[model samples]
Target: MRKWFGQSLRLGLAPDGLALVRTSIWPHERARLLAQARFKENNVEAALREAERMLADHEREGWALRVVLSDELVRLWQVAPPPGAARMADLEAACALRYRALFGASPAGWQVRADWSATRPFLASAVPQALLAQLQQAAAGSGFRLVEVAPQFVAALNQHRSMRRPGAWFGVVHGGVLSVAAFDGALLAAVRTAPIPEGADRDWLEGHVAREALRVGLGRPERLQVCGPAPKAWASSAGRLKFACTLFEDELDPLWPDSARLAMTGRAP
Candidate 1:
């Protein structure tokens, strides 16, 4: 049995933009997900709604319901551009300083994992510096309490690797963004998610998965596992993409059930 329950909350920030997901586990786990909502869009209401909805679901289920908002909640709201031309070197130096400050200062030495999707093109003359700057600025605001900022796909892959399950495995995270995590299990070589583009047909999503599958040396996963409950349409769309891998039953973390119990008992809200 798992020692802690990890429930990820994903939010759809704006109309046809990327989604953000916050993950946390219980038992007062020290290795916790930081409170940082990552997205390219400007929509705090959507972010709040996503978090609140997940908490409500957990609470109703009597799970512990440890809700964490963005660690840099206030800073993220500002959403400003960087002051000067931030070359990659400048960006890397800035990120290193920011990461050191946040993660080094944290008593728990915890880190933040993040990934983002943007619908708009040409955010900067080069790549979008605004979003990266905002993310860095947000991390800087966390009082150096977060150590690392990883892509969400990498986070999911690492988490699954920790489980040490063997086989060509496939996992899905469903909330604001529908993410797929596939691994060879032992090596933890690759985990990837591209934004579900606007007017994304099932073929598009499948193509994304297929690309990742190829990247990870999979002609196709032997089996697929889903985390959280996925919508019927998503499943159907994914099904059409490939003739490989059977979807398997997923066990939610026990904390969700506990949260539900507490809500039903009317003992905790």
Candidate 2:
């Protein structure tokens, strides 16, 4: 008795290139590929053209569009409210001041999204306004409504929320950038991202993971789940840690972001 509606388009924009996927949640076909294309990041004109072409071809008047940008362009921060900040506006100002102090620049023209609670403070991601405007324009031009735009790590985290385990380490590697997140079953403890050196050895990755875990006061994880383009040898390395490790075997492709976004939302589009 599931009712499916309009088609959805998901796009991933990364430093290397842009990727697109289209899917529908109709009962007869819950999900199927419509069209996909890629373009190098340096060539903005070409990338825009490809996006427009794909959008024009598959978009219906009211279809939904979602976009995920590469983690490289997003800056994630964990902030606490300033002392005596009682109002939401005051808290936001405190966060902005802290951000300026940390990054040495004003956050003007940046879209800052936050997940916060009174006890936990804030976990926020700041993305450039120009990038969002570009995506918005593309969606509007294509006759589709842009519903969500987030960083890849955020989308991936949302996609795998159900799989998180207490005292576990989860890592996502995409485009040579590795994003590590730790959970304590109830709360997300830490998140960090770093670039993997070219031709990195197993020892290098293991050391990095251990260091990050320690930084987050995790000591060591009971389990590890890695997604995206990780080396095959990582399994043996992880085994040496005396912890359960799983490497997602699916090849990293353009469609992955779309799939993850869909998994996170559970919406037809």
Backbone N/Cα/C clashes per model? 21, 0
Worst 10 residues of 1 by lDDT: 117-126
lDDT of 2 by residue, 58-156 (tens): 766777788777676678776776666667787678768877987899899999987755455566789988778877887888788999988777776
User: How would you encode candidate 1's per-residue C-alpha lDDT over 1-269 as one tens digit per residue?
Assistant: 14324543332222112222334445343222222233456565454444344334333221222222221221111011234634544443343344455446321223322221121111111112343344334433332222333333233334454443455554544333445555444433343444445565545555766677887676665445443333334454334536333333333334342212111111111
- Model 1 misplacement above 4 A: 1-65, 68-166, 197-202, 216-218, 229-269
TM-score, one value per model: 0.35, 0.79
Best prediction by lDDT:
2
Query: Which candidate wins on TM-score?
Result: 2
RMSD (Cα, Å) of model 1: 13.8
Please give the CA lDDT of all the candidate structures.
Answer: 0.36, 0.68
